[model samples]
Target: MAALFADPLHDQFGTWPVAYIPYGGADFGEIAAVAAEVGNGDDDAYHAAWIAAAERLEAEAETTLASGHESSARELYLRASVFYATSYHPLFGAPVDRRLLDAYRRQIAAFNRGLALGPHPVRPQRIPFESQAMPAYFMPAAGYETEVRPLIILNNGYDSTSIDMYFLSAVAASRRGYHSLLFEGPGQGEMLYEHGIPLRPDWEAVIGAVVDFALAHPLVDPSRIALSGTSLGGHLAPRAASVERRIAALIADPGTWSIADGFRHAFAAMFKLPPEAVADLGKLDESVMQRAEQAVRADRSMHWKVIQRGYWVHGVDNLRDYLASAELYALAGRAEQIRCPTLITQAENDPAAADAETFFAALRCPKTFMRFQANEGADGHCEMRNRSLFNRRAFDWLDEQFNVEMR
Candidate 1:
């Protein structure tokens, strides 16, 4: 095992592996250093190191920007944004913590500044949702700001922020002439940070709202809009697609058919209880619930990455309640409702979900299941370790489906 608290199945150092992706927008050296310090579960140490990195880099960014070196300053500022973002542990009293608030502020300021210097035209805006607005970034393909191109809506995973959608896949989509809109819904990023909204199981409502925004926007091709969900978003996106037919195509990075699989596994492995019992939270013995919650709180790895964050986002204090709420995320009868062409990508080494093949088979729509093995160094969840390779394959599929250009 990588460590006692490593992802029970992936053997990754931590549940999130915040520093695992060395792609753009992050400092590899500093990430490496902070990652090492946190390997043993020193969250305070991790937060401190990353915050220090952000402050130092942001200071440097101001200096270079003053010297008229916008290019150098842009990259530095972006890295600072990433560092500042990494400093805030979502479970660490984030609801009202000034440190988290401050970090979020820096993250946005630096990201917007850096984004303006990018090759594509980007807008940080909000999408109208029910009685409120959802945070998002719209990146029109270079030179196609006013012209309608095929639109790709990107949804980030459980712990990932809205900005992560860009570096993860939006930029790659833009390079291939696709406009990308990256957004955060309940339980993710700013929604959880700014608004007190937690995650809900009916993601179709969240997605339908975005589709409304896309269809109303002048720069979106109503007939060719696709949705790409990363990590936990694999479930969210698919859930949305199950009912939201406006989505022309769908991509589930590391296809996850059910969120219950995670809770089920954790319950069985850690507590030696039947995972299905989680369905009936009210029936669970209070003593059993206490023990399970205690186990989660005791394990530093589970505390922040899974249980604590789950509690905060799901608005539950106990693990049983959290798992009970997750039961709705399953696509039991809904998979057949997805009428759009769908692609489900899987990492050979991922533990995000089991029986993804069954989920793929369940889809009655035009579907493709693509698998990445360990040899390519792309076997981690969402292929984060080598997203370029994964994106190449995914976008190639998109290009063929949409009849777009290739390199």
Candidate 2:
């Protein structure tokens, strides 16, 4: 877990793809090479380095596929997709940079091509939602491609695409004899980037559509369907599960109490504000908002997280509205409504897991809290450093809850 790049922001984002190594999403040497190429580089340099790696892997995938080595081609294409996905984080802001758009498109293409050649049965889907459709993929469990099998629907948080979800959860779930559905909801992937959709607090409506899709599928076992959300999805999935009773089991990776809660406490600690002053962040006065904006803009990490990525995802034009919009994502009264068997995970060093205990304590369902430690190499956000361990424990719990025989 040592720093991968001198730039803190780069170090954090750069290490994400490493977690995908177990599923052929990357090789540590390739990632290390890219990191060395981008040492102390600015946003553009970071973008250029990753883009170069992605293109190289993509061309290799094409040549390998042409020679009919599908398995090798699958690995190369999937690896390329992860690199392309990693390349655009620094470029995430309004007036979407042309480079970001192009990289994202290539990322999707590589991921889909890889999926077509994978061992499992995969289908690209367009799940019906309000007016626009959410892009999704239904991957039937490897050996149960023609049978009714329990389904694990994977949801990603803040910045990950549906492709990231596949390496993070879907592939693992399929190997365990569980069908998988991975989708991009509002404010994510193509939903936001291609269709102009922004984030929404009412995720129940969004997930309700996903459940409908699963129910309609001949291979998915509706009665045993499970939902797992990671990162910001930690909150979104629970919020939806609260109302979507069809979800028989739930997993929130590093459970979050709310979107604004973390920011509120961080602000209070940073500026020494009294509890009451930072209590209702949504209603902070204009001057206070200006001060917060100034504080965020002063740091490169905070600038991208709050001003650029935050504003764009929330469909807001100013810091105040973004904070106001975040207020809608709270799970205070909502967590108690989730009735399914639930599992919440906490990673030792993940700042987002600060509220995992609070979220776990509030849950009234049959719930379990799983904690990952730094010594286990699974302490980062979402246990990105050692997801093989995370996935094993998570699905084992699901299997127990659903009375599933071990595979």
Candidate 3:
């Protein structure tokens, strides 16, 4: 399986173009090597390789952007996005960079262009749900231009940038012929920084707006639209699908029953602070809290602060308030309201979802649960590091649900 999915680029674009020869294949080679080295206990080496590739891609992106070659820049950015995704999480238990602002800025710009050049004729504008406008990048299939093919809206999990949608998952859907839209809403990626729209408990409204937009578009198959969320999105997507009956399918990886718990863990990891301190700090004024989040994202030690602020954005005043949100439990209660087929993917050793089995048991729907071993190499939260494996499983299941015949 590892050999089959060895090259991330292969799974995505199916081989780099010869036009990339100028780079001496450094970027593509580094990516493949890093993927091979990641889980073999050579985490530090993997991290170094991943970072070097990202830096190279970034430089290439700068040149492309400066030349006013939007198309080229977009592709370069797409490659860079994959590199960043690999490096974003430092393995060997190292601290995250406190100041990734510059890298993130470049990433957002690159992804924006990528999305702009790649448009699904049916749904052209990929707008955000919040009042502040942010673009959602989506692609529509060739033949299903008239029918309402089930629209699958993809959301990233905690600490994920929407750019990953382009390099990580969007390509798979494009290949599989699914009308898919990928976006960062609220506490996610650019939406949190560019727009003041923080995370909300009722993600249904966010997805609801997306669904409405898809249905209004000339090409979307409204009735067959589905919601797919990764990482924390696992929680957010299900919450939204429970309320929005129009969504025909709900697919989540690493099921979540509490956003508060998610925040607690993230804050603790990012800031290297105790959960109590993080929770206490969250009670401060909204402006103060936002600054803390920015500070944390900039400073590795303060990373926990970023996680805490994320919780506060979702209406948690403190740890107690967070625990009380009952957002996940309530969403679970409403799962029966979902009128579509559902898919839940869980990691066997994921600490975040220690109670995943229990949570899965509570879900009431036409659902399929897949358990992946931690050693499987694609078992991380939302399987961010393993795009090929994630796509193989997700698209395969989606095809079965849609009754799509294999080509």
Choose the strongest candidate by TM-score: 2
List RMSD in Å for every model shown: 3.4, 1.2, 8.8
**lDDT of each residue in 143-260, candidate 3, tens digit only:** 5534455567887776565555544556566667777787777766666544445566778877877777777767676666768887777788888887888887778777776654
Q: Estimate each model's TM-score.
A: 0.89, 0.98, 0.67
> Tens digits of per-residue lDDT for model 2 on 1-407?
78888789988889998888998888888889999999889999999999999999999999999998999998898899999999989888887888988999999998888888866635578999989989999987877788888999998899999988999998899889898899999999998888778999999999999999999999888799999999999999999999999999999997988899878988888778898988788787667777888999998989999888999999998888899899899999999999999999999989999999999999999999999999999998999999999999999999998887644
Estimate the lDDT of model 3. 0.59
Error of 3 at 245 (Å): 0.9
Which candidate should be chosen as best, given lDDT against the real structure?
Answer: 2
List candidate 3 stretches off by more than 4 Å.
1-55, 58-74, 82-101, 115-130, 142-148, 261-332
TM-score of 1: 0.89
For residue 286, what is the lDDT in candidate 3? 59
The model with the greater lDDT, 1 or 2, is 2
Q: Would you give me the overall lDDT of model 2?
A: 0.90
How high is the lDDT of residue 157 in model 1?
82
Residue 263, model 3: Cα distance from true site in angstroms = 8.7
> Relative to the true structure, how large is the alpha-carbon lDDT of every model?
0.76, 0.90, 0.59
